[model samples]
Target: MVLSAKTKQSGVTSTTNMDKPNNSKRPLSHATDSTRTSESCDVLVLSNKMMTNLTSEFLTEQTTQPDVISKVLLERNKLKDLPFELVDFINLEVINLSYNCFHQFPSVICEMLSLREIIMVGCEIEALPSNFDQLSGLETIILDLNHLRKIGDTLCTLNKLTTLSLGMNYFSVFYSTLPDQITKLNLDNNHLAVFPDCILALANLRQLNLSFNRIKELPVEIDGLTELEELLIVKNRLHALPSTICNLV
Candidate 1:
């Protein structure tokens, strides 16, 4: 599945129809009262009888033809663990589990081989699974507003990854090395104190965001990012920009 637009940071709306699921009866889950105020809940209220029938049909179809079930949106469900039945969707390519109460990255997602994009914003995720590299087809990952302190080295093994967003986290250092295929990277609103030299290795990087951090200075080696087009360094502690930045002109 081709993603036509980037995931927005404000709300759970998408610009493309691909983000919408095929079944109209299945609505996106909402935040539970324990996770959010009742006034904030946007759950679709269905009669108990209707819900039971829908659930029965869903299980039957999923059990018989799991490959037909692709694209899942469980946003704002306050879920700590995915339902075991979700594993039946073997052909899933896109999944959005954003705005939940997860304390760790759900291991069930790691088992999906066809996943191309995953959005898990505003959660308590601390770390990715060690075997996250198993998702070779993954291209975009948005983990903004989580509790991640550092990423595993397995992330760099996703050679097809092009867009990665890790903003609004608690990272104090850039520990994980990025893949050279990355085109857009967002590290804004973190606790980084140093410019990671590993970023210079992304020869295909076109957009980079380092805003709202504690970085003191950038290295002259940044000039090596010849493909960079838009660089955002706002709200940082940088004293001066390197003269080599003018080379981009």
Candidate 2:
């Protein structure tokens, strides 16, 4: 990997060179900034053909745009209307497809057993597939800024999910089933007025973002999120948080 550095008052600003090779059959890798800077920042160029040759490839914790990548970003790229047959060729372990314009998630994704994480933020998706529970190895699923109103029980079956993002959606239905393995959850920008008790089941949860919602009060049992580390409740209608949260932050 080649490193490019620039002068900054704080220190050296470095960007990794991840340009994709010019190959039509290659799986391009797109790069996303953890800081959420610009839309045209960088792409994590990859060789789709080369990656297909490998048995196991892990690409955890990477962000992507909507149009180019299938796993990350807002608008589906019109140029990448791959056939459903290509689903079997995918071997990605982590996929961050947040902030996109997909109306619905492809049903073929259920066949991808190798996918460990799926991040589809700001998409127009409404509901997850019924077979989503088949993803036994899935550990993280971030689906923010969507038009979804309810989560399927199939999703709650992902017992290995550690992080979940359901922010900016239409949660009209009451959540009764929550994954037990979630450690970080983002429920900001929703239509919630009260903190649901169902979330307390996540014994390992460390961070909870509930900002920009219609919540007016919190549950007293919120301290049940024992492993809580950071709780972001900004821009909400909440009058106060439980005193127990003070020690977690």
Candidate 3:
């Protein structure tokens, strides 16, 4: 009942607007993507640089030394696709490409095996690549505000995933099974009329957000989520209550 609850992704990789990268900067060309922080630290912030496409050449040109970076923040860019040369980042882990104009998941990201987190909010992406399962090391995925409807079990393979944010999209139905290890689930502002049955199976779930939907009621079997801690249910069409909700305590 904190009213501040925000929904995360359901069965796919998603991000949130709140978790957006720092995109506060004057519009610059892709050539000047490097920032003062990247020159000194392992975290590279290439946000608000007006980049339509990120290239390995620019990565190399960012500094005289082109080696493994830990985190790369490329928020509020116009990136649609990444170069294949991106695979050279063997040790790269976290990448933030939020608030872009991509209509599809950048396939080059699939090869980064060491990656753990991928945050890309406010994009036009509709589908994930076929090789998305290759990233077994992924632990978090934030992909809010896009055209995602069905996940096709792409995220189910990410056994390491714990947090997924996919709110503010076109999800009227979600049949894909999410990872049982997932601790937080967000499905706000979608077209869901009936509560997703798949969610009831997550015994380890701690936080759940089903706000801003068309759901009318909850099932009495809701008590199955014994580990749930925070539940957000705002702006729904519910007229009745499920007695099992009391068991969440």
Candidate 4:
């Protein structure tokens, strides 16, 4: 559901299995481009496109229906930055910017207040933008395979965040910044060498993954996750399981 504009430089269309974005030059409802105006787009798949950026020509028309787009998928591109013009999509909720070479978190996303999910896997982002927690509607964030080592207290402020994935990063020590609101967490393939004591405080965490790390033991305090339905700790250096492991049902 992205603009099927001829990229001024690459001559690419930047879309996968959806309708072309509406513009003054195109019909309101083409046979394929059915998402227009009141028929808000639910998903926009722009993955695997070689696009480096979304230019003004592609963004010039989204303002005509600021509430039309709900999701934008921009994975597997060579993008390093995003156009600020994206702020016009007032109703946008989900965004996937995976497999790009982004060195920094795109700050423009912090302004999209309606966002509920953000997926930015395999990027180079080492830090989140300031005031990131202000997007109070966010529920899920996947930042796997990035350069992140620490995220401040910003994440815990989003009360709606329930799912968090932070695998394959540069983390050596776990950060206690995790919120109790999280029900699912993934920290596989990092450099962690200890069972992070902070996780024992998450009374609401239902599933935890700590596979492929250097951890040598699980603590008896892990029974604090009384609600845990699934726990994975394969491929670690543990000599034995904690005695309280049987407490989790």
- Taking every candidate in turn, the Cα RMSD to the unseen true structure, in Å, is 11.1, 13.7, 8.4, 14.7
Candidate of highest lDDT: 4
**Could you tell which candidate, 2 or 4, scores higher by lDDT?**
4
lDDT of 4 by residue, 22-44 (tens): 43121211112211223335555
Model 1 segments beyond 4 Å from truth?
Answer: 1-65
The top-ranked prediction according to TM-score is: 3
Each model's lDDT comes to: 0.68, 0.56, 0.72, 0.72
Please, what are the lDDT tens digits per residue for candidate 3 over residues 1-249?
A: 112222232222222233422321111112222322465466767889999978777888864443557777788888888788767767778888878887888888998899988877788789888789999999877777788888878888899988777777788887878889988777776788888888988888877777778887778998898887666665667765566676764
Clashes of 2: 27
User: What's the C-alpha lDDT at position 33 in model 2?
Assistant: 36
lDDT of 2 by residue, 1-249 (tens): 211222222243332344422321111112223213234433333322222221112333233231233332222332122224435335545554443335778665677676776766655788887788888888777777788888756667777777777877898534758788787677767888777667777888766766566666667777777776555555556544457544443
TM-score of 3: 0.83
lDDT over C-alpha atoms for residue 65 of model 3? 42
Clashes of 4: 0
- What range of 10 consecutive residues in model 4 has the weakest lDDT sum? 26-35
What TM-score does each of the candidates earn?
A: 0.75, 0.66, 0.83, 0.81
- Lowest-lDDT window of 10 residues in candidate 2? 20-29
What is the full ranking by lDDT, best candidate first?
Answer: 4, 3, 1, 2
